[model samples]
Target: MDAVQVVAEPRRREILRLVWDEERSAGEIADRFDVTFGAVSQHLRVLRDAGLVTLRQDGKKRFYRADREALGPLAAYLQSMWADRLDTLAELSEAAERAERGEGTDT
Candidate 1:
């Protein structure tokens, strides 16, 4: 699954956002959600399968956090697409400016 699919679920997205800054225990993360722990676990499984998160064992507890490397590709893809959109907007803006200056398409 891609990053988009991984983050498509609202609960999963919230989990990722919460864990983005620091590693969080399963219970700690689960507590923030209204759903049951089992439900949250299922969401984490999807995220882990998508390579968006990593789990580390600390004694008997598991700590989860966002995988920076996995998220990097997604970020790059979004940046590239946003840049193209910005370029299109810039071109439209320049055309509008020229039109305002009486250098429209008819001229």
Candidate 2:
């Protein structure tokens, strides 16, 4: 599957986020989510197949990390989208705090 299709799933996008900064073992990745190990494995497989992630095997464990170079333009797009969402979340949180302090209403 192409990178776009592979990352279309929410779980896959989150997996990418988890590995975006550094390499993580499959078990570590699985532990971050509430799903079964097999489910996380499937997502990893999809990411590996799409060349969106690089996998390394050591002894009995597999580690994964995002291949930002492979993602090319998509990486920038994802970063922009995530930034926008975070900005929106920050705005909403500030608004909630203001409301709690009774300072959000006009007049």
Candidate 3:
């Protein structure tokens, strides 16, 4: 799945958020979820495929961390979408205010 798909899943996003600042071992992440370690591992695999997270082998443990650059596209996409919607909503609110004040014209 793509980054968008990966992040859309709440569980996967939680995992990403947990590891956003620091690397966490797979076991550590699994502990936060209600599911089993295997389930968390599947979520991690999806995030890995989307390039939103990377894994490293530290001795006998597997550590995962967020990949900021890999997530840049998702950030840009969300920002642009919010910007457009916010601009439209602001314009509508202003028009509503003008109509309420008898300043808006049918023409």
Which candidate wins on TM-score? 2
- Tens digits of per-residue lDDT, candidate 3, 1-95, equal 67787788889878977897799999999999999999999999888988888999989999999887999877666446557878999999989
Quote the positional error of residue 32 for candidate 2 in Å: 2.2
Q: Per-residue lDDT for 95 in model 2?
A: 87
How many Å off is the CA of 40 in candidate 2? Answer: 0.6
TM-score of every model versus the real structure? 0.66, 0.90, 0.68
When summed lDDT is taken over every stretch of 10 residues in candidate 3, the lowest stretch is 73-82
* Tens digits of per-residue lDDT for model 1, 1-107: 78897776778867887787799999999999999999999998898988888999999998999886888766566446557878999999999999899896764
Model 1: which ten-residue window has the lowest total lDDT? 73-82
List runs of model 1 lying over 4 Å from the truth.
Answer: 73-107
Compute the lDDT of residue 87 as modeled in candidate 2: 100
Candidate 1 CA-lDDT value: 0.84
Higher-ranked by lDDT: 2 or 3: 2
- Clashing residue pairs found in predicted model 2: none
